[model samples]
Structure formats: structure tokens, C-alpha cells
Target: MAIDPTSPPTSPPRDTPRLSTRDKLILFVLCAANFMVALDFSVLNVALPVLGADLGMSQSALQWAVTAFALPSGGFLLLFGRIGDLYGRRKLFLTGLVLFAAASLLATFAWDPASFLTGRALQGLGAAVIVPSGMSLLTTTFAEGPARDRALGISGTLMSLGFTIGVVAGGVLTDALGWRSTMGLLALFALIVLPLAPGLLPESRTPDRPHLDVPGAITVTGGLLSLIYALTTAADHGFGRADVVVTLIAGIALLTAFAVVESRTDAPLVSLSMLRRRTVAWGNLGGLITFSMMSTVVFVLTLYLQEILHLSAWETGLVFGVQGIMAVIAGSLTPRVVSRLGARRTLVAGLTGQGAFMIALLFLNEHSWSVWLAAVAVSLASMPHVAAIISYGLTVTSGVPDEEQGLATGLVTSTQQVGITIGIPLLGVLATTSDDLLSGTRLVMGIDAAILLVGAALIALGLRTWRSAGSGAVEAEPVGSR
Candidate 1:
């Protein structure tokens, strides 16, 4: 029988497949890669002082080791994401792993600040490719609904755990094997993962592959780099610094031009129409809010625990270690929560819960008992953070085609990095403005809580509208359609 070409195409029913051995192996490799990238972000923090001393770096110059990595990692995300979509995700993923490993090796052997910084920057570039490509692989491998949800839950847990692991690992490695061990460990991990990836991961690319959007890529990458640089610099140098102001303005102008270019380009790096989708738009916004507030909490707590309470680095790591454990447990439970309440409602509940916990931080003080209370508050906060992360990821990627999964994941990852970059400076300024540190901490916590609540409200409203529109569309369909 010949099918009529004029007939409307039917959507495929969402199906969940049982995980086979190969499937499980693929999941493990992807999660491990995600963990490595995330771990790189925080693992160096504990080693920074010792590493700097060994490299003869001054106090101020030491900060660039972090900035060097962060700038390219965040800046190149979108460009690489689209590249994965156009080229091949598996190839990009493999390239990222190899590059990251080589950079790690270089850093391990670096004899000076400049050499180490070069390695760190290269590692960042590799991570820029790894994260989105890795995520695209996950989404494409697992079918939507239960399968993708479960995979995302595991992936998010590992990512959150990676940060905690990095903190603890950095301390232990630096103390036992010296600062070089930190970079060496990363190199070792990358080498272990590299060989397995080629056999385990599958290749994927868009069907109607379009030409690369050079102009859009250039403008967006330049813009994000400038913005991130300005944000980070403002944390140490005042916002009024001439270079910071100039860079900030240039970033804005370039980003505006990117929007214009994307709107008119034949093969756009980011589809403007995708941003108009409710889930992608609102989900990214929610992610932005979650990461910014959560990161600020970490920054403020670090100061409180160390400076005000006079706790050692090990003690602070222990406190966060407990929080990280809770985050993993929470991430494990997210799939169940989503099954019960759905992604939108889950997101709202998670956001609200996190806000409530942030409000509880208002009572924390310098007393020993207060430190325990702070730990408890942080532990409780992790549950919602994990929930929100998984839910937002699902929401953003839910209906997107496999071809654009890289782009979608890129947006999510980019917002997360941007949030982290902006949060420290934005909230740091607030914490510094007050006369007293305790008073400043309280003020910032209050503001963070408010922002979380506002974000929840906005998401809840968006969900309501989406549901209403969905219902209307359904009702308009013919009764005998099936």
C-alpha cells in the first residue's frame, strides 16, 4: 500500500527500555566523564595555595589559575555544543577526553606559573567540549520519559558529587602526595576513561546538517568570554575599574549582535525559536536562579566557617562532604518524585524547599552548635538542589529532537557556569558592603531566599500557562483521531 505524503506525521510514543549491560556501561562512562569535568572545577581550589607556593606565584596571580580554566570553559560551551550537533558528538567527546588528559599531564609536569596556567586553560577548553557533548550523548541514548529521567538523575547526582569529591580529594591528595598529585590524578582518570569511550559511546549528528555558523559562534564566544572575565575580575578589582567596565560593555554589545546574527543567519548556532519554547526558556531561567543562589550560599558559608568560626579547611570539607552525600541521595530519589508529581511541579516544590532552607540560614552564628546547624541546613538544601537540577534538565530537553540535544544541553550548562561566575561577584559585593560580616551574611541570605521564591512563583505560573495551552490544543483535535 502506498502511503499518502500529504498526511500529517504521527508522534512516536515515548518508550522506556530495560537497561542492558552495554547500556549500563555507556551510562557509567558518560557519568564518569561528567564527574571528571565537574570535579575539575572545584578540585583545584584546595590545591591552589600549595600549588601557587611551589610555582612561585604571588597571592594575586594564584587566582588566575582558576580564572584561566573558568574563562574558556564557560566561554566556548555554546560554540562547541553546536559543533557537536553539526559534526559528531562521539568524536567531540573523544577529542575532549584526549585533550583534557594531555592538559592534565602538562599541568602535572609544569615547572612555572605560566606553564601551569597554559595547561589549565587547555583543560578548560577541553571541558568546554566534554560537558555538552557528553550530555547530548546521554539524552540521545536514553529515550525520553522514564529512561532519560533516570539517566539524568544519575548524571546530575554524579555532577553534584564531583564537586564534593574534588574538595575532599584535593585536600587528601595535596597533603599526602603534594599539589602535583591533584593534576596527576585527573590525568590518570582521563587516561582510564579515554580507551573505553570509543567502544562504548555511539556517534550522532543532525540529519539535515547545516553549514557552521561562523559569525554567530565568533560573536557569542567573544561575548561570553568578555562577560565572564569582567564578572570574575570585578570580584577582586572593583567594578569601576577601567578595564572591567570596558570589557563588560563590549560583552553586552557583542551579545546583542549575536542575537541579531542568530535571528538572520541561515544555520544559526542557537535557534531563536527554541528560546521561545516555554520549557527551554523558563527551565533555563530556573537553572540560572538555582545555580546563582546555591553558589552564593557556598561562597558565604566558606567565609563564615573559616574566617568567622575559625574552622580548618578539613573541617569545612567535612561539612560539605555531608551535604554532598545528601545531594546524591536526593538525586537518586528525583526520578521517583518526578514520576509522582511530574517535572513542573517537582521543580516548583524543589525551588520552594531550597528557599525555605536558605531562610533557615539566617539563624546561623559563630557558636559551635551553630556550625552543626549550618551543616544540617546545608544538607537539607542539597535535596532541593538535586531535584531542581534534574527537573530543569528534563524540562529543557524533553521535546527537543536528538539533533539539537547538544545545543539544548549547551544552554543549560552555559547558564550554570554563568550563574556560578556571576553569583560570587554579585553576592560578594553585597556581603562586603555592610559594616559587619555577620550582618552582611544575613542580608545576602535573605536576598537569596527571596530570589528563589520569586523564581518558583514564575515557574509555577509558566507551568500553568503551558498546561492550559496544551489542554486547548488537545481539545481542538478530532474526537476520533486515534
Candidate 2:
């Protein structure tokens, strides 16, 4: 049934409809697509040195290869979400998928740094559109129940799997088929998804969804791009360059203006009133901290493995693979844990475990066996951290109405990307300024520990409100109803 977007959703009647197999397949396809998008980002890291040599890219240019994708994916997520709502989600998702596939094809053949960077940016834009719209589709198709929980669980597992496998696959492809082939493979996958999508995926329900907020989108996108550009340049430019100063100042002013506009607009791209709620505010903030600290942890550990331990790129990636195993285990068991322990307690326990593990890592040295022991420590350490992040995500979206879910999902995604962006620069500074690499590694880990603790504290403090308001069952609700 087409949604009357201007009217709030009426409570469903007595008979809850069962989902068709087509619905399930559609969700699975979209999840797989999203997984590919996420995996390509990190998997490319292992192959960058090779790509840099091949294309004659300087460190700055190579960095842009990564940052270009990230900035667009993060910065325009809110804009894409609003677009999905205003237009039709299924239509936008399909459009994004086509664009993404085209970009991937272009990336596969690119011989120059400029072309590759452009392809990466386009791919990021595609992700920005596809992700939230795909999510919106899932919610509209599923009803509130066990079915939705299972679908979400599957989607989450696919994400974890993607992150785990992407690095390994990227390495294998780079070694055997070449870097271009890896990208070509993604294009093939996207093409496969596109044909199946039209028949399987559900259309957007919002018939009178608000109009596209063009000024809001442009201003916010420009502000985010400027901010990211400034920070990324600062890594090489020492933060003193005139361009950096100008970009930073302009970015701040534009973002400030965005906040003011959001407050005053009748149908804001992002509803400020939604943020005023304690759950949305605290939950997203905690998520931001969690992702930021996690990004730093990965950065520092990769450096430690490669620089100090003298491990090869493939070997370093292999070591990090243990975290993926741990994440998969945690993600798989999350539903059961939420059922048994409740969301609040589960989140608390996960944060506590992660923070403790990070603190213990501060004791390792160049000669110590603790470095080898790290594999086991990290495996255990990743569980709670991943679980807590998943838990907090569950909390934030529980309160969002379906029409605005795209916005909610976009906000979370944006927050995470922004966190990782900030974490890279801050932690990079700490690592570069230290006397030795090991001390720098320790400082980074210690800072990660502190950040996790703060995130934990926020989760703990927020638990009271969540428990009183109730948080879990809603997230576990059927995708159709969400």
C-alpha cells in the first residue's frame, strides 16, 4: 500500500501480514551491497602502497583516495536520506547503485591519480545515497516482530563479514588479479544486484514526504567537505597554511549556519526537535566516541605491527583479522545477549570489557611477549566494543518514526564517519610527535582506553533513561514495522 506521507501511521489492524520470500531476498541483496561498500574502503588500505607506486601519487594524493570516498559518503548521507524521503527510496537506491557500479568500472581502468580519485568520490556519493534508502526499504517491508529482528541481525552479520573479508580479499586480489581487478569485481557484483532489485525491493511509502531541502543539502555538504579538506590537509600542511585557515573558518561558519537553519525550517532536513530527546542525543554521542576510539585503535595497532614489529602489510592485516573473528562472534550472539541480559546491561558490560582490554595494552613493550599475546587480547577485546556500538545503534533508532528513519540512519552514519575522520588526525599527531614509535603506540592505546571509558560512562549514565523508557524490543522489531 502506498503511504499517505502527510498523515502519521495508523496502528496496524489485528492481522499482521507475513512477508514474502521476495522481501527476504531483497533485504539480503541490499545487505550484501552495503557490505561491499564498507569492505572496499578498508580493503584498499592494504593495497595503497602498491597503488601509490603504480600511479606515482604522493602521500597526499594517496590519502585523498581514501578521504575522498569517506568525505562524500559521510558528508552527504543526511542529504541522501532526505532525498530518499522526498522522492522514492527504491528509486533513489536503484539510481545510486547504477552510479556506484559505473564509478567502480571507471576506477578499474583508471591509470592516473586524478581519475582514480574522481571515481572514489563518485563511489562515495553512491554509497551516501544507497545505504539509507536501502535501510528505509527494509523497515517499510517488514513488520514489528521476530522477522524484523532476524533481518536486522542478518544485515549486521553481513556488515561484520564484509569488514572482515574485505581486507583479506583486497590483499589476495592485489597480489593475484591486480588492484584493478578487485574494483572490476565490485562492479560485477553491483550489476548483479541491479537486475534483481526492481523485482524484489519495495518502493518508498511516503506519498507526501517533504520537499527536497536543496539549500540545506548544499550548505551542509559544502561545510562538511570544507572541514574534511582542512583537516586532511592539516596532516601534511602543519595547520598553518592560509588555505587550511580559510577552509576551517568557512566550514565552521557554514555548519553553525546549518544548525540555525535546521531550527527555523518548517520541515528541516534534520529535525532539531528529534535531537532534543535524551536518547537520540546521548546514543549518537556515545556511538561517535565508540567509532572514533575504534578508528584510533586500528590505526595505532596497524602502525605497531608494520613499523615496530616489522611485519609485512599482509601479515599485519592477518593479525587484524582476529578482530574480525571476534566481531563476528559478538555480532552473532548479540540478539541472544539482548534477550538474556537486556540492552542496557549488555552495553555496559561490553564497554567495560573493551575499556579494560585497552588499558591492559598500555603495559606492552618492544621485548615483551604481550605483543604476541595481543592477538588473543584483541579477540576478546573486540566483542564488547562491537556489541556496545551495535547496542547504542539499536537504542537511537527505536524512537524514530518510520518516515524519518532515513534521517536517523544517516545521522548515525555521518557521526561515525566524522568520528573516524577526527580520530585519524588527532591520533596521527600523537604518533608523529612522540620520540619513538612504541611510546607513540602506547599513547594512542592509552588515549583509546580513555575514550572508551568515557563512552562507557555515557552509556552507563544513559542506561537509566533507556531502562525506564525501554530500549531493546523496538530495535528487534520486524523490519516491515520499523
| All models, RMSD in angstroms | 5.8, 6.2
Cα lDDT tens digits, model 2, 1-482, are: 32221232343322222457777688777887878777866778777878889888987678788878887887788888878877788999999999999999888889899899888999999988888888767656664334444455556556655765777777787888778877887788789888989888877745677667666777888888888777767755557889889989999988888888887788788787777655567667776776667667777777777777777767766777888888878877775565444445566677778878888778767764655766666667878866766655555666567788788777766776677677767776687667898898888888888877877776666544333212143322222222
Off by over 4 Å in 1: 1-17, 468-482
Residue-level lDDT of model 1, residues 1-482, one tens digit each, is 21111222133323334788998999999999989988898888888889878999998898798899989999999999999999999999999999999999999999999899999999999999999999999999998767888899899889888877788888888888999998998898899899999999999999888999999999999999999999988876669889889999999999999999999987899988887777788888888888888888887887788877888888888888898989989988887776555666677888899999999999987688879888899889989988998888887887788899999999989988998788878887777666777888888899989999999998887655443111011011111222
lDDT for each of the candidates? Answer: 0.85, 0.72
- Give the least accurate 10-residue stretch of model 2, judged by summed lDDT: 473-482
lDDT of 2 at 150: 43
TM-score against native, each model: 0.93, 0.89
The residue ranges of model 2 lying beyond 4 angstroms of the native Cα positions read 1-20, 144-146, 235-238, 467-471, 474-482
Clashes in predicted model 2: 10
lDDT of 2: 0.72
